[model samples]
Target: MIGEQGDGESVGTSAGNKRCRNKQQAGKDVAVQGTNDSSIVSKCSMASLGYFNDGFLKGFVNKTTRRAPLINRGYYVRAKAVDYSLHCFLQKTASYSQRQILSLGAGFDSLYFRLKASGELENVIVYEVDFPDVVQRKATLIKNKQEFMELIGCMNEIKPAQMDNLYLCGLDYKLLGIDMTEIVDLDNLLMETGLNPACPTLLLSEVVLTYMRDASSSAVIHWAANRFSSAIFVVYEQIRPDDPFGQVMQQHFTHLNSTLHALTQFPGKEAQRKRFLSEGWEECHCIDMNEFYTGFIPEQEKRRIEMLEPFDEYEEWHLKCSHYLILSASKGDLKTCLSFHPPPDFHAIKLDTFDPLWICVSPCEIESENPLLRRFAHCSSLIAPNIVLISGGFGSRAGHHGRLRGATLMTKSGPVWKCSFVGNEGSIHLLTERMFHSMTSFCDSCCVIFGGRTSPLKPVTSVLLLKCEVGDGTISSISLSVKEIECIGTAPSPRWRHTATEVIYKGQRYLFIYGGRSPKEMVLNDWHFLNLEDYSWADIPVIGPTPESRHSHSACSWKGGVLIAGGLGATQIPLASVFHLRPTQSGFFWNRIEVTGSFIPRYSHTAHILDDKLFLLGGVTIYSDSIPEVTLIDLKTGQSLDYHINTNLVKWPVMLHNHSSVLLVKERQVLVVGGGGNCFSFGTHLNHQPVLLQLPEIK
Candidate 1:
């Protein structure tokens, strides 16, 4: 009798622990469902802006908030990728009398209504599976909309109260509400609901499986492969969890209590493809959205969408695409099925190979009294051997975030750096209240500042000359003066994200401003020469052929002229071509210099020319898993190679885009100051301290 009593108590304790685990899991499931609400709202925003023609997305979203242009472009690509997969599946099995589409974790998606309205569901059936609560809510929303009910041809068929797992039963559509983690019950439920095993099936899991436990998600993949005679599985999820962008993306989901489990194991495209092949699949193909956007989408369609909104967030857009991918796995007769094919002209630089070049990176030691360095899209120039001038960025000011109305001067004393804010109460405000401006120092005490924007629509057009005076090389005795420069001639358009390099023409100094964007124009290709002696637009032109129109490119003075490389081209693609403005007896002529290397194309980087070698630092690229590397190109040999930076010495995520960098020639080090951007929906990330990268000895 005592033994029986002990067994009863042990059973009670086991049941109590099981209930606690179940409750915790239920809460996580709710958080995962919340992601669908936000996703649909973004989709609705894209749809309303004519990115795509989806008439039924409005029924799913309660309030349609217009998202940023970056978010809209993100959703547009996602919708196109999924639609591409679905259309491919249907076209391949068109002769087959029956086919099925099963969307896993499909929460409030208007897939069925959209497909039905398009008359693409002639002999096709779509089955949606999700949590019971989400399915019920979706059903309620659908029933409340008369157009949805009419499209489904079941005005009174979906009885939400009577539904437990099967929320709706129609001639071609089925809505099932159940926990997919219960693999055994889910299989039984699908089989009992008239799912034909012989039919060609396509399973869709859009940012869904990553939310579940790895084992649970794998079981679903395994079950689908075994159950369907011929099938294709399409999955969309995040990758590259170790990079700065990936870290921010993972943290965003973690903060919402919905962690992405698969990223820890399958962190990239190759791992994701192998994941399905290891779990009872014959073949798999994977590509990131970056590849899809450049290779798969039609040019006309791309051009149409690119002009739908004013966009200057190319860094965020490309980074967002690189972090996510679409993968398709197949089994049985559908082993040849693929979502899309890579373009014949597509070629990616092999970034995983070892490069011989390396550099050491460390954070700069700044005094505690220095102003906060949390800013991006700012300008930094080497005003003196020990003084760095930083001005104009979108960052924190007076504990609030906006365009900075002040400039900071960083002076080096011994090995420590000290910074003080320049006055903002007077003429300095004109030079400090702008972002994406260009600053070129003409001498040790003077620099020319021109062309920036307070906002996308408010660009600063007036030119300003800043002069610095240093006394006894002390921080307390340094003073600065700013004056407006009135140039006589036709000036260039008001622009930002341009480069101003000092080039010598006939032993006369000139500030050559080239390639920027304006609020009215997305990209500008024209160039102008500001004669530094007279401060007027010089009209000495003998150009053979100009480079492509671009912005956010890197330029530096080389061989008495300007050498420009790597910028976002007119098509919004990063350019890999390099051009040198060779000074001639007649005037200046553009010369194309062919660079030989497996160089990944990038933009928004800083460049410097030293001893016949051009060093390009820290840019945004969509083709590689690594952060921006210092690309070294030999000007004489036309050879280039990427040098990796040892980021272990830095204490924070080294996001290099939209930042400024200055090369200390005497120290043989580059100071990377103030970088980072609004990382999609994750949040704004600004590097709080300046990082210094020591250059290695080059031959």
Candidate 2:
């Protein structure tokens, strides 16, 4: 299935080498031909140049004319998509403790150098292969440029004789010259470069296979499939050649006299997926650039880049993007190594459709346990693995008003719940009796609780600290401490129903608090930060458009920012809006997320970050009924899915206000405990005890 130019030629190693050499030589030999290897390489260089121009990449300088804004944005999207795939592979293999990357037909690509500059290559080995002539040119350029050479940690000169194939001993970088169609040479060079087939590997082929014959390219794919025990092979190239836009694209390459040989044979997404599946790959997924740009890229980033230049080529841009596709094929432990599918194992609940078939874990069964008093508006923080410390809420028990206790939700065969009071037997003095406060774990053995109401009309300005020895499968003892943070300037008024999250900045931990109801019944949007080291408070001036003052919202740390969603706004109306507070040099800035998918606005819900997705469970909706819905938001793609729980597991709590959820990372589940209900005002619904909601498999 070779191209028309050499349909009858033998697909042997020598023939493949001849084909590669001829392709390279033709560029210099026939200047009149529009299509040549040098021209193809120039296009790649131009794409990279576009990325640099559009600010998608840095440290790269373009020596040629600037491209159109549309072209630059297109290239930026392409580079970003490929880079994301590369990052995903790296992240997946990180658990295995070893990883390697191999780029086939790599010509003038700067990925390895960029990663090295970012210090991401510390534990990774990178290898690049290209034609001998091309490799020679690149090696010579690197040798002459001190900056390029330094990237590989080279202190000495690179000898001209060793330019064809050599490894940088100190940098884990290997550059080689090999005809990829020649399987024996490819395998030999790979072995010489010290490739470990058992290690998780990422093999990238971007626009490289289109120049090879069908037999040749398929052979390369098959070789990688058979050799690497665990690997992900990614391909980026043009497809869909029959449509008008695709015809123009094909004609453009044809006019250059460089036929897209492999693309002609496999010219669509389905064809590409089938190609990998037939080549012994265990899994394959193919998506066009259009879908990737619209659905996969983060919306905030997309918005930021869209304003970089004036763009009006919408139709052409869509067509052009649709014509290019990214295909990934994986072999061996697809989920553990290189799964391209969205996490398949998710437990969720939606409101509108409460299907009966879905299932939730049974309420934990405990025998002869002194359970904590029925309470709402309490705070819970996981100070240690399998241990949760809950404190201070409105309750009916004699000692429940200002109580502090610890519970161990152990998982050996199944979940086991045990409760024990913390602090010395006679020492039970806390800063104040409070409810609707926030508790965040810090320093491994301690937790900090901030601002809550001691009564409906009074808020406490005190912060409490709880330190305990709960690890090692037993809780030997616990201690209570208090701190009064001092503010040099104006301090935020005491409030309840606020949100507090821990953030790490410049090697120091700080607590950021946002939005709540003041003691005067006034809603507030003020933000403050408490330095953990000094017990000092600082009022942060918020920049950009701020979210409306709200209370009973949920907030969690994500990508160095706090994601706040679903709360009662200033108008006393429940809000579905989501906002992110990002740290800046001047102050904190707010970004209101324009999220897609149907999201129900609710307050007093619990949100947890599991893997890369945000899970929102059980909340009071606008209608004042407990919403039995679970919403999952993918942090990277910003896609949301709402699923309804099968209430038959236990009678669903009528209300979910002031509840707490702790993520069990090892068990892949969340333990949701204690909330109020319409039927049972301020107490726990005994029938709806603590429940374990499963999470997706860890990536």
Candidate 3:
């Protein structure tokens, strides 16, 4: 908790770290409106990306960067998104007179200066307004900063600390128009520069609207719209209300959580731009955070992109952010305004996940990861609830030698790595302990494993199970009680490289297997389920709509039969659609789903069930290696929702893929123990600092 200053008020209190109000503090605390009457803004550099590296979202950002937000995927994505878009926005017009560029709540931004330095705005004059502390901090950064000096120095060209040509007004817009003047005395500054409102382009607002009270934010738009004749406003921000990238920041800073202080109205970006329509700013176009990379970007650029965030939902950081949206508009007719902003310049980098988070590592976190585990070829394994389990053609590490080792067990207290030691140490199965296969959990402490090739050329049809135990302490180790159990049933066919799932029916546990490879054929479409209690595999007659025979599709437990979302083989192209089935109900009812909206068809994406909600995590999109975009589909409601999950988070944050996400001792933290990424919402591109660079970290 932050200690009160002599004035009885907390100093440097940020959105992420505010002292919870108690009787004593609440009675004594007098809310002090910012007294920095000077025209400037104060913004703390809050690290938002690290929040995505939580117990589930790991495997997306590098662990180092997630732990250190100042440098992760969040940082780079923000830099590139803003710089590229801004550059494109500015390079268009030849003149800049009436084109007013006002950045709302501008935080230590350098766009105005960068454009000025390039002489790109010879006819343009920029205006920035913010809190006093923020403006001062930016000034100080420019004066003393090294690597960032050049960037900040660009703004120093017009500074009285309040800005000359670029007037820097420092007043809270949450109150709206009370302290603001119709004119800020910037006429001389503009006269000296010979620029006014009759020219070309105008306006640049980046990641600024989230901090506003809707009315005030709208007022800003209204004010700018009225001030400029033909201005093309550019605004950028993360608009999700419950975004993991912004909400989790409450841990690091008080009052900053979406629940605490974010603007409540005009929530989504589309809604925001539409709000401008009422204010006379016509011809608005917006890009959802995800579309920025998907629709605008080429397939190749998307793969190399990655954003950052914290690792857990309850950890010190867990803010969800989506969209680096750019909105352009004008006061005149729609056609002219639309012509100002070019579409070709608006490319989205599809490879990056919206927010960054590390996979989980705690017991509670792991229990949420996977109740079932699987062992496949090499270290390669598959887990049901594809949302979090990871897969790999990349091979293995340590003793577990393949990719996607679903061989993990999460108890109420911690995660027990059982796949590494099938049957007990003394068991005959442990003698040649098999690795690399398929696995999922059934009942209290049982898991099933299957087919995995030792090498690219080899194939094996073997299934195994390791019993779990309710042990003591965080799951650092587990000693299996079952000795030997390499049980085989009259399974459909001997195959490797397939997906597996477990479901309960008529009070019995059944394992459903789908799509694998055989020595004779490269891919097979066989749906088989093994009864764990009877140790027998049965081919239930599956009826209803079905896709072509295929493998690698994410088969997860839905209503009954596993919901297969994506996979490869048929037509040699990956699948983008999803389907579900019933395991034991007469003929397995297979239902094909409508893969609509922004849902890209491909393989390698993960789908997991949480609170009965199916969340699809990162997977290969289309023909690219870029991770699958994450989405949420409520089984009870059948309503599909889109959310930003670190594409690499397919390993854990909300889910885990091929990797092992083991929950640690803490109920809040989960460890991505090993294997392909499989766990909860924790992991990192490193510490997930917020995209808004200047927001201070919550202490």
The prediction achieving the highest lDDT against the true structure is 1
Note the Cα lDDT for every prediction shown.
Answer: 0.86, 0.65, 0.44
RMSD of each: 4.0, 24.5, 14.4
Cα TM-score per model: 0.94, 0.46, 0.48
Cα lDDT tens digits, model 1, 1-699, are 221231123344566665766677788888999998999999999999999889899998878999999899999999999999988888888888988999999997888998999888878988999999999999889889888878778523534432568888777888899988888888888877767989999999999999877878888999998889899999988998988788888889999999998999999888988889998888899988988998889999987886798887889999999898989999877778774555565565655445456789998998764445889888999888788888888888888778886678899998899888887645676665888899999766888998988877888998989888888777787888888999989999999999999999999999999999998888999999999989999988757778999999999988889999999988788888899998999899999988987677889998887778888898888666676588888989998888877789877778878989998888888898998898888888888789998877789
lDDT per residue (tens digit) for residues 45-77 in model 2: 445543333221222323444555556666676
Off by over 4 Å in 1: 1-17, 155-163, 352-356, 369-371
TM-score: which candidate is best?
Answer: 1
C-alpha RMSD between model 3 and the true structure? 14.4
- Name the weakest run of 10 consecutive residues (lDDT summed) in model 1: 1-10
Cα error, candidate 3, residue 469 (Å): 10
How close to the true structure is residue 149 of candidate 3, measured as C-alpha lDDT?
40
TM-score of 1: 0.94
Q: Report RMSD for candidate 1.
A: 4.0
Ranking of predictions according to TM-score: 1, 3, 2
